[model samples]
Target chain A: MLKVEVDRTQCQNFGQCVVEAPNVFRLNSRDEMEYTPDVEDAELDNVEAAVDVCPMQAISLALGR
Target chain B: MSPPVVIVGASLGGLRSAEALRRCGYAGPITVFGDEPHAPYNRPPLSKDVLGGEVTHAAVAFPQRAATSDVEWRLGTRIRSADLEQRSIRTTDGEEVRYRALVVATGLRPKRLSPRTATLAGAFALRTLDDAAALRNALHPGVQVVIAGSGFVGCEVAATARQLGCEVTVVGSAELPMLGPLGSALAEDVMRRHVERGVRFRMGTHVAEALGQEAVEGVRLADGSEVACQVLVEAIGSLHNTEWLDGNDVNAAQGLRTDSAMRVLRADGSSWRDVFAVGDVARFPNAIYGDEPASIEHWNIPTETAKRASRILALQLAEDPRLDAAIAERFAPVPSFWSDQYDMSLLAYGLPALADRVELLAGKAGGDCVYGYFVGDRMVGVCGIGMRSEVLKHRDEVSRYGHVPIGEPAR
Candidate 1:
């Protein structure tokens, strides 16, 4: 399992993350950010791509204990 | 035998291109040349954390995200001349290298101030890690700093200087800072934020001259007014680093002109099949901008263009038939850029240069808000401060209907 965290204060919501990992992160009707805190190990690469494309350097990922 | 793939300018674009080649299963010899001795690093923080003494050059160096450990790197070397006819480049160290495919990512250099002002001891320009490190050390509490130009670099430096407890004043030739790309509404918001933080602005005036003979004592404005300062930082503009390609048919005056697929265009309006250009140095036509040849300085353009160039280069080298259709596709990516100043972060999507009108879609104009920039009826660009989610929603809309009609209700 993996845990993901996003610093809301630092995030500008450019949606580059959404384009990379749509299953993990998304935008709601009001265009606000929504994401899953935990994900399967198979989704690691997708989540990592999201973390890399973040413009504000807000996303972080770590393996769960 | 096909020659090795050669990449010039080992910055973000060059580094990414190397990685993309490997990802496409290109196991051939790959060589990267960079004039800078250091590895590719994130430049956005040079004006932010680097100037504020929050981080060192090593801290900002780009992480090894791609599989480029095998790529041969020639650091601290410059290509003096290039022979497009022979498909070879001469280096400063009296070495010539041949290439089957060439990728030019030379990027840009900061436009220098006047000869008089540029030669001043205390005056500086921020473009590389060394520049940021020196400026950070020079800036201290109570030091007076005057910045010329109100672009992203200039505004960001002012914010960092202010955070360092320095007396900062910014001079710009426009009525409002960044009024051209950000529009007047959002530009006003940015100006208000700076004023509230005690940073002074000298709008609609240029820096006529740099004061003092030995060092920069102050700067003289076009209005015959002088602002006393100990240091002067010039952030006027940047020119493409295309001097080495002088004898070539490239549009060196503007930038290296390229076709839609990022192929270099010769003087006769034809593109070189084996040569490609990326990053700030590539002036290529974009479908989103109505096929106009535009060079984007944003951080995202380099990454996107590099990916496209690598796929094309790999296909040619490997003679892969599986991805032949992919090569015919045009190079189009949703251009985006961000600027951090004080506590406010401004994020924009699409090319705002084509917009003729700017409208406040959400929030107050002078406050944290979102503004939609339109070219007549179509929305060409969107930018907002502290309105991250609101601006992200319009990303697809801006790409699909570049001329999306803005309703009167939003206005």
Candidate 2:
């Protein structure tokens, strides 16, 4: 499985993540993103997409069991 | 097995998120919904280039290479409801989209004048490309223009109006323009700049009403003073697009409240891991400023936050080992923003709201110079008028959380 994390301290709510991994990352009602912290291995491609799209460069990932 | 991705609000944040996803190698189909009929475009230049008649609307179109992932554009459609539990969204067109994840970048709208004033023909607000186009047409030579608020947008409009040869008067209740961010002293410099350029200032005054019948004929000040003008532009502030999420059980006010990871916070102040928010619509805490959450309205912050959100999402998908640590380290980017008014270019680094004190480091006031804002002894933010190269060099250091001598001059 893939693991996801966002640095809220650095985030300015730009919503670039929504465009990158719509399956895993989303902006909630207040125009903030609502996303899953973890996903199945099959969704790795979309998760990677999320990493590339975050404008603040606040997103990070690590391989896990 | 592909996961569905749905992004609402097809503007800068939406477009950049889509681009970032493609760059990160996501081949899944993507859907981007926008309330506007036009394709995603840059908005920064709307008040300047487009209004100045220096460039056409087409010139501001965000250049996109066809190879960048293809996004299913749902233009001219508004999202009526987002059923977070159902993992779906219902659009105004009655279409339901099921998504494994969602991104809300609905941004904010400009606050308008009261209905009593909006009925006047000359009243205007600039927030979108269309709004700028309409205002540009209304600005003609010899027109007397009265602008409300002395904020960045209002100041830019005032400068532009003067350049267009219009009789411009800016009315504000503050002693100087932009006292909120630039402070009264620097704001006075800005006000003086406009005065030197022939722009008039009605300082320490408030607009009681915008007067006119068919069009704006004049404005009534709180002091009972009447200033006649042919046009009025309201630049008071912006309202976040969060009313739709009313029953969504999320902790949302003017903007969505999010943690460092861009995840929406519950009403009880807990993170809602399943949902995330980005853009001007979300309010999150800053690490450098004692963890006080800030809602910034700038072009650069949104772009940077989206990139960080993407990386976090990718780690989750890859089952990253450092996921917990990564999330904890999120929200560390230094805040930065810039604005162009008349011949002056103002660049700001760090959050001015968090600064306890401000001092001029280099250059003279009312001229090309660099000013640094400090929180105690550490330089928390920097602002420069007409000094781009010097400011750009210090931006990285600020972003990396570097500190300059508090009261020392910038040599």
Which has the greatest DockQ? 1
How well is each residue in B71-150 modelled by candidate 1, as lDDT tens digits?
Answer: 89898999999988899998999899999889999998888778776567889998888788878887898999999999
Which lDDT values do the candidates have, in the order given? 0.82, 0.72
Chain A TM-scores of each predicted structure, in the order given, are 0.94, 0.86
**Model 2, docking class:** incorrect
Which portions of model 2 show Cα errors greater than 4 Å?
Answer: A1-65, B1-3, B318-322, B396-411
Itemize residue pairs with steric clashes in candidate 1: B378-B403, B378-B404
Candidate 2 positional error at B379, Å: 1.6
Q: Model 2, residue B172: displacement in angstroms? A: 1.5
For residues B107-171, what per-residue lDDT tens digits would candidate 2 score against the true structure? 88888768766556889988888778778888898999999988878888888888888999999
> True contacts preserved, each candidate?
0.43, 0.00
Worst 10-residue lDDT window, candidate 1 chain B: B402-411
Prediction-by-prediction clash tally = 2, 73
